[model samples]
Target chain A: MTDTVLATQAVREESPPRRGGGRNPLRHALLIALGVVMIYPLLWMLSSSVKPTEIIFRDPSLWPSSFDLGNYVEGWTALGAPFHQYLLNSAIIAVGCIVGNLLSCSLAAYAFARLEFRGRKLMFAAMLVTIMLPIHVLIVPQYVLFSQLDWINTFLPLIVPKFLATDAFFIFLMVQFIRTLPIELDEAARIDGCGHFRIYWRIIMPLCTPALATTAVFTFIWSWNDFFSQLIFLTDQDLYTVPVALRSFVDGQGATSWGPLFAMSIVGLAPIFGFFLAGQRYLTQGIATTGIK
Target chain B: MTEPDRSAPPGGALSLASPPTAPAPAAEAPPAARRRRGRRSQRAVRDGRVAYLFLAPWIVGMVVVTIWPIAASLYLSFTDYSLLRAPRWVGLDNFAEMLGDERLVSALGVTFTYVVVSVPLQLALALALAMLLDRGVRGLPFYRSVYYLPSLLAGSVSIAILWRQMFGTDGLFNDFLALFGVQGIGWVSHPDFALGTLVVLNVWTFGAPMVIFLAGLRQIPVMYYEAATVDGAGRWARFRHITIPLLTPIIFFNLVLQTIGAFQTFTQAFVVSGGTGGPSDATLFYTLYLYERGFGSFDMGYASALAWLLLVIVAALTGLNFLLAKRWVFYGD
Candidate 1:
């Protein structure tokens, strides 16, 4: 859902030019300047994280003269619970979401795309409309529901809906991907005495690697970065995800720990950065195709 | 009801992969086997049952998590529910109260301003960058990837903290401004500039739309540019006549999507304003206000009303975008 490239056909022929030419240097120079401006904050964060707390404001230079590792050590235990615990919590949520979304969404997508069922079209349409229903509308009622179920302060509120395939976006993405696949494979399998479930598991699922990868990457990132839900539900300090834990450092206290906060901030962003770097292609590809199709 | 066809379509690859759970076919049965196997009457019912089985999780979730909450919230909007007490019916009271609530009014104003200022700016920047990148730049994907990084970090608490620090009175922005002998205000704490800083933040994440714009730009046939050049059309003419017209659909799409997103913006304002949506509620986004009412003050009923109000606004805006798009958005079909 990130971007929709309305006409992918237009740019397919033009490979990125390898050799530089007239005016290219100026274009490169302009791009370089913009890139520096864009990336400076991240560099500044990295610089500030290593700088001594006293010099952080005074030394505005991105390349800090002094390197202090104390911030990293201090930030770990800054919020009573160790930073590793928060990372572990985020990891658990992300992993749960990935597994749940992959399994449930793909199952539902298969039904919508391949299987003929009563109310299939109607159900699919209903799911599409839900995409427009803002998360704001659900926040209050969901909070109340979770509280009433006595599931507050636990991962259940965060993780349970994922297992139920509540994310229609991914389901729609997988359905689109599944439809593009050859139906002849299913027919051949059926003739060979393969049942629907067997065909789904062996034939369809195997062929949907790209779509599944996109779903997994997005689910992991979104779940890991989900602050609002985790913040509301997991009131316990120990159960806080990375984003929630990061918020505690900047809770408008009298004496804010800027150094450790910046340090932990870098640490918290590391996984997402790493994930993006690893799955950058798939992430953009997913976003590009998911909505447009 | 459609039946599952047993035969493959013409020109299909007949090479079948090994199926994990394949059942043994009846070797001796012929016409009876065909009758049993070709039971097209049962196929529709069987497929329907299996489809539901596969869709079970989503069906349950739709009812339990999504539908129920939406219905409950709609009901709660007309009630007086706090977390502690059972909801009492109060028809139109909550909505009526919103008419006079100064903070809620300001919150809506702040949110509308944020969306108005940010979405277009972000999309403009995105389209600009995309046009530049579409010029057969070397390592285009690499540059695209780098630009997209900011969007990945956008709306994170860490980024908000970093933003506040960067824009503080004695922060990096001020220090940078010192080189030009200009004094900078504490952008986050200053009411006049707090919303501006958040707007800057929203604009910084233009990478998402930029990539999409790049795709849209790519969709514009190079032949159009070539033809324009043959007619002695300059760069600006070609862009105005060809690119803009062709890219309108994407522009419209991004506008609608980004508007909805900007309207829902909460984390940036929340974290920047220290979760108070202040320096005098200057940065109190509608979502943040709803959150504060629902969680901070435990006024669930009013919050639900506010939430529904947001949904209505977004839906109306989206609907309007579609109606307006008819005048401008050109599909190449």
Candidate 2:
């Protein structure tokens, strides 16, 4: 009897029918139409990247009169700074940020989550307050500081602070994930004569792989897409990231190459999309838990 | 170091309590057992030092990078500190100038309008899509991945480039419209429509919020819906009474985050306006204006002031959100 009631509850929850079956089909059709509308620009961009300049403006709807791979080749060479150099620069900064964040954030998160220390709650709240502080406010002084240290035009300004527990959002995320772990594991490790650091490394770090992966993926994406910072710091053409390099393709004067610019953009986004597809499960679950909390 | 005599009278008496156990002979006793144990305890104390040792790199980075830069920025906002020379003391000049600047006023207006319009529209679209996907739909994961693809590529330089094309005069949007005998205007170049194109782009990447909404919807008890259904509540009535109220907190979360994000929008404006805030500076956002002043005009002092003003505006908006959430957000607990 209870089973039947529970089954009915599930069915009703899944499908709560309203008035007019006639209206249902209309709503469904409208949703599909909206989805296509949302995706159309992306499809159009993909289609435009392969078309020749004539067809680009003339026959915009044609998939391509012929497959022209020249656009990618020309775009890559026309970057002034080699396209591979920009990709290399982006990779170095992103990887450095990921490594830094993983080590520092996880440690800070473990302390905040499990350790009983003086001023722990206060420190955590201070970290949270930093999130509200806009990055724009700090840019001028940060530039001055880097200039003084002779660090301008280098990746250090972009890559080094991340080694600190600077991004409080990710730290808070790690803290919450650590809190959900069973405390009995810590107690058992302690009983076996394991110290706090040992317990964290041997037990907690291993279990927190999914959270770490999420943080790494997000940091990689953010670092890769960072435009303003790269523009400000790296003035030398050789040190430019992909975004800055792509911007250089458009002369400030009248000349603008739509075909090559679009082509480079497609190439630039390939790695990020690939990364997202590979680790999307962890990313979704991480975001869900983070938002719900 | 003399060891404790295990065969002594008290040791023998202690062992006698357990008949199966016998005290070790004194001749076989180690000479420094107590000393060794004392040394081992000291070693354990030394081993406890590793925690701070492992954390030293982060502490150094915090002091030199994060903490110092923030302190310097706060101090620099008070002084005339262009990059070429040493900063000179100037009290409140930057802030006072900002109050009278018409460009700053218009930039703030544009930014607030962008935030106010884009955030709610984005969240509403996200919630609607999430609800559609929550119905045990077939190919749920595939639909989700497709919907989420835009967000993954949302803030890239490429998306901005793509947006420029899609909204251009002779671009695909115009072509699509021409089929219906409707002529299209230059969406990116026209001052009236440039900001609107950005808002549409902001709204298009509603995947992150939608995913969050989907998770929140999943947590609402199925029994509540069943009870409402059994009471003969219609679909619209059930959603209005139960879904919206229960989902308010998550909606509030998305509002605060998206508003902050929208205010910091720089990429689309930078790329679309070709980094010049073209056609009478209509696409000049707060951050874009900041970039122009600091980098374009080389006025670091005024830009620093602008940055602080942005910080204050964001803080005020967030504070307002927290104040209002109490009245609307329904916590299940």
Candidate 1 clashes between residue pairs 3 or more apart in a chain or in different chains: A11-B218
Model 2, B1-333: lDDT tens digits are 123322223222122112322344434547686556446435433432443444455556556666776677667778887788888779998888888998887798788888988988988999988888775565557667777778777788788877877788877788889989999998888988888899999988898888778777776777898899999999899999999998887788778778888888998789878897665777889999999998888788788788877878888999999999899988766
In candidate 2, which residue pairs clash?
A: none
For A162-194, candidate 1 gives per-residue lDDT tens digits of 889998888888877787788999999999999
lDDT of 1: 0.82
Residue B19 CA displacement from its true place in model 2, Å: 57
Q: Mind giving the per-residue lDDT tens digits that candidate 1 earns over B169-202?
A: 8788999999899988888899899999999999
Model 1: residue B115 alpha-carbon error in angstroms: 0.5
- Candidate 2 local distance difference test against the native: 0.75
Q: Which candidate is the best by TM-score?
A: 1
Cα lDDT tens digits, model 2, A1-293, are 11112222232233333323333665557666877877777766667678775667777654677778777877788856668999999999999999989988888787667764323344556666676566787888788888888998999999888888677667777777787789999989989999888988999999999889988988888888888889899998889898888777754312256777777888889888888889887666655654311
